[model samples]
Target: MQDLAFRFLVQLEPENASNFVSLSNLHASSGRWDSVAELRTRMKKKGIRKMPGCSWINVNDEVHSFYVADKSHKCTDIIYTVLDSLLLMMKGEIDVPGLGCMK
Candidate 1:
């Protein structure tokens, strides 16, 4: 995994933020906090910023895109409130491992 990522970074798209983020995620999943932090620090030093991941969905014939820490939507507050309620309900029903849940 590291070999392929390094190849992509060095040969294909060295300046791409996604490459850095993917490598950081690999490190983080392996309990390598220092490596993850180092990768992020490098990205910052190189002026490379990772774009937030987003999900697109269709509701009532309208399409909406949602991103982490997003505040541009008109219904951001209400959407968050509903999501919070759903998370709380899920907490009572089962343990969602690896997912950040309302505490």
Candidate 2:
């Protein structure tokens, strides 16, 4: 894998490159390399440039935002590691892999 960040499928706008990248990452994480290659091929044919991801938080009536591949935050790695750990724990409890709608 190309670093740990390549393991997640982040949300993206419809028909955007980030959407394809997200799907590709999802496939990679699930050991579906063929699907990842297919997604890349389609993206290449469509001339899509992978877009940066963005996330925001509302705290004390203030907004904090960040983008994928951004390195401005000092604690980004720690934050993500904690998140991954939490996700693993949740997955173990629920017997589910990957993010899916709860039912």
Against the true structure, whose TM-score is highest?
A: 1
Q: Write the per-residue lDDT of candidate 2 for residues 10-97, one digit (tens) a residue.
A: 2224347766776687779889999899878877887778766789988799887889778677678887887788887776654455
lDDT of 1 by residue, 1-103 (tens): 6847664783577679888888888888889899889888888888988888899999999999988888899998899898887887676764555665553
Give the C-alpha miss distance for residue 8 in model 1, angstroms.
5.1
Clashes of each: 0, 0
TM values, all candidates = 0.67, 0.38
TM-score of 2: 0.38
Instruction: Pick out the ten consecutive residues of candidate 2 with the lowest summed lDDT.
Output: 3-12
Would you list the clashing residue pairs of candidate 1?
none
Tell me the deviation in Å of residue 72 in model 1: 2.6
Badly placed stretches (over 4 Å) of model 2 are 1-48, 93-103
- Model 1 residue runs over 4 Å out of place are 1-11, 93-103
